[model samples]
Target chain A: MTPVSESLRAAAGTQRVPVFRARGVSKVYDMGEVKVHALKAVDLDLFQGELLVLLGASGSGKSTLLNILGGLDVPTSGTVVYRDHDLSAADERELTRYRREHVGFVFQFYNLIPSLTARENVELVTDIARAPMPATQALDLVGLADRMDHFPAQLSGGEQQRVAIARAVAKRPDVLLCDEPTGALDLETGKRVLAVLEQVNREVGTTIAIITHNAAIGALGDRVIRMSSGVIVEHVRNERRASLDEIQW
Target chain B: MRALNRKLLRDAWKHRGQMLSIAAVVSVGIMTVLTMRGAYESLSSSQAQYYRDTRFPDVWVRLERAPESLRGRIAAIPGVSAVNTRVTLVATLDVPSVDVPALGYFVSVTDDRGATLSDLHLSAGRFVSPRRRDEVVVSDKFAIANAFVPGDTLRAVINGRQRDLQIVGTAISPEYTYAVPPGAIYPDDQRFGIVWMHRDALGPAYDMAGAFNEVVLTLSPRADTARVVAQLDRLLEPYGGLGAYTRMDQPSHFILAGELNQVRSMGTMIPAVFLTVAAFLLNIVLGRMIATQRTEVAVLKAFGYSDLEVGRHYLQFALVAVLLGALIGIAMGSWLGQSMVGLYGEFFTFPTLRYEFSWILAVLAVGVSALAAAAGALGAVRRAVALPPAEAMRPEPPTSFRPGVFERLGLGRLLPVAGRLILRNVERTPCAASPRPSASAFRSRSWSSGCSCSTACNT
Candidate 1:
């Protein structure tokens, strides 16, 4: 068991193991006249029930690495294994299955289907999940239980983002990956959104990884990895993770 | 409902205007298909039923005159079931208030027999009595056109003698259902008519006593109509046969069949054009919509939806519009078809005419429409699914704009800010909407006014 999974077992009162192992993963985008390397031989392990923040500036390959781990993309020349399944060797169908069963993602823009109400959006995932929480329960977890009937257009920015979070977690996947979830929000709204994330991590024991350029947000994570120019520059383990409300941007 | 399906409903409702427009185009195509298909089926069936009920002749021949004794010999020919000999003559009609003389065909009516080939359907009044030599039964269409009913008087110059003929009845006959003036392809009932008179009256009028000018023959069941026609032609050759022809060669049936052929081809051709245009329009609109939803597509993918699921969501949107259009088309076509049948009844004189719905045609229409919509959506759906989630979620790269050669010209410096913006926009994006007004004169005047205003501002 990895250290992060060990910590997750402690949090969940059960034995947990590493969920993802990426080895020397690299991604190259060929632009006809030029080849742009997005990820350069990166290796990483994601365990159960830990909130890991990847901190980087724009063009730092942080988002690309998160995508590879989430099965939304494939590594050009390296292997990524999710539990016992080797992602690099998997076809498109298998990769899609892995994402469906094991991963949830949140984006900078809430990406809630505009036509669907909050509860319906959450129900989208729950309907397809093998074992999922009720759509109502997921909304309650995000503190938007009363607003479940509202459409994304009718809700405020923070409320819509919370609905997106509820939608992502409703499936009760093994891991939750969020990319710049607070990038579009004000300071107060961002803090409230982060607080929800903290609560979900503590309650569900779901291994969570968030990508952001803001260093202040990293204080809420159990581990922080910083990237620059398609490579990791620093990784730090937080001895004590702070509550979101205690930090000021 | 499934969550995805619920999303589809709401999405369609939100864009109801666009959805309805596409559906309207599709409906036009389906409407054309239904109207033509229904008309074709109804007309063909009605014609067959009319021919059968009237016992229409298989062959007809006309000559100067033939003795009545030849009727038995003609009937004795192989496959000949029945024969009728009549005196036929054309006369000039003089109706009141009509300056031009209308042509009238005065046919000799046989004795009142229960079973006679080419029987007339009396629509109004009684048939003329054999004793009343001056009484006549007129074609219903001609009577209707001239506003003449039973007991009306018609003056006809028969064999150089102008005599008053009393109309006793108005009737329709399968032989002359679609009558035309000689040398014309279409009927002009106001200018031409058919009048049936007694044989005793017509025979002396034409100065042909105990003789006939025309013979019509009916063949036995399952007999060859062509072979009988050929034998009749050979037998009557010595007595001025003129020609013996089958029903297919008869002017009324021949012209009607030609028109029906044109309609059938149009049923295929016109709908094809409408459907093709509709499909092309759907493709363009759906492509633009999918392009705008790239980020949403990425988000769906990130939510663990397979590419196929995302594609299916968009396809369902198109199919829903198609189904709605088809239902509207079917309703509209059914109503239009009934109206068309009524119009044809007045023109074709069919005893029974009704719109016939064809299930094969309905199925074909729906199948083609579904195929068209699917084809229209294929390109857009593929693009939506092929997008990489990571790339699609990222903001688009900024577009860089630079000055063009037009901006460097000395005269261009005198242009106003609006003019400069137009020049730069044109340079920045060649495909941008045109800045010029669609009205050509207004576009020239606006350009001149802008130049004058810009020079004044610079001064």
Candidate 2:
């Protein structure tokens, strides 16, 4: 048995609830002439308020697994349960509602609307959220309070990524899913972004799952799962997670 | 404002040029509609009211010499409410500093104004008095065209003798509102005019001292005009009568009605072309916008915006463009409409011809433009919402290309790089490159939209 399942069993013995439970999940894409198997029978459990790092090389299905857990896509043949909701059985509309109420996603490229200021971009998600943090407060959490009025074009790449982070967290979602959140930044900037994500998870107690190709980023998480060829090969629990300043590329 | 609405405003401002282009097309369409519609209403209504106020004759009969006693007989006919008898003659007018001899229809008016069936609206001067036998009242359009004023003297060949007539006044008559010479399609005011003369002078000049050459009849409201015309023609047949006809056959009214129909048709046809092009341009622009904004759209979807919300956003953008165009059109159309009324006054004489503003037309224009803009945005908006969030968030795979069908037909090697590039783009967006009439935004709209516009005008 993997260390992740073993930790989960230990967690279950302590009566700690999980945020998500996914079983036998597989995704196949039909490209007309050929079938591409993106995800193969994957079973995973995401515990409440814990930081998880999905570490893998490109095309190893880590992002696919994260996407499925976030309800961004449907599995070809599997069951995914989020809290009391059955994500596998949910239609598009139900999934949209689920995402709006419970999920926050941060992408590699900060897809901030160019026409909008940083503050306004965050307000976009908060306006539709059932429960949300104030946009200014969210920006303050991401250390972008002074740069709220600057448009995406006027900000640096690291600042834009911070704004994207603020926009995602402003909704006060229960689960935060980040897919390569610092893929395009310099070493220092990437470290700064990781620090913000770490701070957000610590302060808000929001469950976080970050998928990344950089193996070093895995040291910051409470649990790290290494994936290869659409399956987890290794899972380890950290007794002491490393701080942002102590880590180097 | 909500964040989404703020984004809408800033995005629209960023693409102001495209939005303004769409608005301009809509403005042109509305302007055409309002201008022609305003002109038609002003002309038809003014003429109808003028004819009613003057109690214009419904039927006219012309003969070589009809005895004055025939007036009583015509008045006694069933449905004939009034009969006006007068002597008429066509004379050649010779004005000073003018090389060509102009045609003049000289009709005698009664000294008693109340008894006249076809009355004149004096515009500038007094009517010709009976004592002033050589005085005349010239048609208003003719006077304006020839630059003649009251007290101007004109020489005319009256009954084979040259006579000098003084222009006492300029008058507008419903009978000569759109005066055209006999057998002429359009009015030539410079070469033809109507001169109202005294009965005592005109009868003697034409050598018909006690006989009338023209008879005008006004019938009851429900009178059969054709039957009355046939009866009058037969009764005056022995007196060398040529024929009798109702107002529908009158050259002035015929030409005026034809002109009004033309205005209506032009209003419908021209705008249809402009609006159709506008719709096509809007579609192309929105389609391009969707193509470029796929990432933003995916982000919006990931942020929990539903497909309906995204669709509404684009539709609202399209509507905003349409609204801008409609405002420009309303201003432009109103100005054009008023100016056209002034222009029409120069050709058609009316007592009260003015620009008539129509609120209904304005409303209709706005409604139609809204519908057109919405329709143009529908396909683009749908495509935007149909983008899956997962695939769209990542970089799209590069478009694949194979050696086209032409290569299989052995024609690929003959094509140059530029030709292949163009063909590849054409294959990617087939509508943009095709020669099919409906696919073209500019050229083919002229014919197809013209047909649609004429139909709209008729309705």
Candidate 3:
């Protein structure tokens, strides 16, 4: 194990190996007359192969923490170490390298390129990935095998989100960060999208972090962290995680 | 193909309307450039070749009369290579087929039909036979205008005597490529013609048995034409010399050169305006596209595609449009150039006029157009590459809407709801309304200028 994982394991009082260890991370947006503190001195850890949920209401900084963890952003103060890489000190190029090699992200909106078909969307990730599954196989894992030839415009909202998920995981990344992946879908479609995410984590043994405002969806994660105003208010472990079908809004 | 390229192709297809409109504008710009340049090249090359074949004079002088023996002294001037002196006279013609009296410029050819400066390309029949007083060759344009052919007879009153001259041939000369009657700005072939007669016959008829009134000569390469003109004027002054001048002062050559300059300036100015409008349209379209594809850019970056890759994807859209325009422009330009040169053949007679397609010109057109398009696309591509992945995926903040300038000026209450809404919309989306007004203004100005030019041409 690396020194970061060892130290994180000792701090957590458990044998779990952390893929990310962020200490007192903060983010400030300078909106001219006022400074908006999106994230404040919040220390956190994301363990390897564990499905984690970051639950909070709107403006609670849950998405900001997830962004910092995914290397899409850097903290204003404090350090963020992913494995042995110091993401806090990384430049734009180094951060891009980190994202390409290890991190995968899914936004609330599917963000699939409308001009590309489902399979081609997945192939975008596979094209530059060091080691990747075939785009067809990734689509199949997302239950979009039959719709692989369909463009995003032709697919339903939920199906497009599934394609987004397929694109993220095709690279076989070390961790998957999803921010409200089902936020735009209907109840039935949302459940179907969540089941795909659950299946990927269960089958691939990939670490996952999901940020959402829905508290009921917390039962699907191995651990949960509740945030309020830019700081972590509660952190809990679920003894037995519920299946996707059992979770409700 | 890579997925990004596939996306580029499909996105272009989806927006084919805007893309093709931009391409059409680009094509017009390239076509104008190519057409003007091609026509200019055709006129210049044919003029040069005609001048070379005819041994057109470098200097010309006219006087009351100079003894034929003086040709030897004029030829002895420094830098003078070859000289030809002949008696030239103008006479009134009474053609049987024409009601009005025609003007005839009578030039003397050698009795033996030997080569001379300002030679003619024969179109039909033959040159005047040795010492035949009545046999003459007429200009091709005058011959066509009057429907005259070989063996036709026309009466000319030369030096108070009327003589029936028989037409032996018809020809075109480089010296009179843009021939206009004396004191006339435009050619009137029906009222004027050139009549070439044997020197033995024409000299004595004009009371110059062994004398000549006009002199034309060629100069050696690297010779000072001004110095030679000065020296020739001094020698001929005692023989009633009027003046001596080089080809630059020759009316026909001067007019032809001026026309060519017009073509060159048209090639430069018109295309510049067209291309500026094309670039403006491309910038507006691509900017809107990038704005709408904010999330797509974010997703691409978030999925490990580099900023350069994303930027390239958008630039390819512009390249495809420009290439399509270049192909259309090349085809249209070549055809239009051929037609334009053919039109020149009517006014300025050349042995042959051909529009040759230049690969260098085609390459330059494509290069310039691509450069303009890339410049137009630069701002939008930079915006896409600079967007932070995290922030772009989120919805943009709501714009703070307030009363527009018109509303603040107390004009809001006087306007209808629809008019007020439009004002607000224009204020909110300033870019949408910006280029159109300027483009329309430019178009109207171009139209008015074009109308004025056509009216001037008609008069």
For model 3, state the Cα shift of residue B30 in Å: 1.4
- List residue ranges in candidate 2 displaced over 4 A: A1-14, A84-86, A89-91, A229-242, B56-61, B64-87, B97-100, B110-118, B128-135, B145-166, B183-191, B198-241, B244-248, B409-459
Candidate 2, residue B35: Cα displacement in angstroms equals: 2.9
Minimum summed lDDT over a 10-residue window in model 3 chain A is located at A1-10
- Maximum-DockQ candidate: 3
lDDT of each: 0.82, 0.84, 0.85
Superposed model 1: Cα runs more than 4 Å off: A1-16, B68-84, B93-101, B109-116, B126-135, B151-157, B160-168, B198-210, B217-232, B246-249, B356-363, B396-459
- Candidate 1 lDDT, B61-127, residue by residue in tens: 9987888888889999889998988999999999775679999998888775445678888899988
| Model 1, C-alpha of B317: deviation from truth (Å) | 3.0
Candidate 1: residue B445 Cα off by (Å): 26
Model 3, residue B251: what's the lDDT?
84
lDDT for each residue of candidate 3 in B41-139, tens digit (9 for 90 to 100):
889999999998889899999999988899999999989989999889999999766788999999998843345998878999998887587899999
Error of 2 at A248 (Å): 4.0
Q: Estimate each model's TM-score.
A: 0.84, 0.84, 0.88
**DockQ (Cα-based) for each candidate:** 0.69, 0.67, 0.75
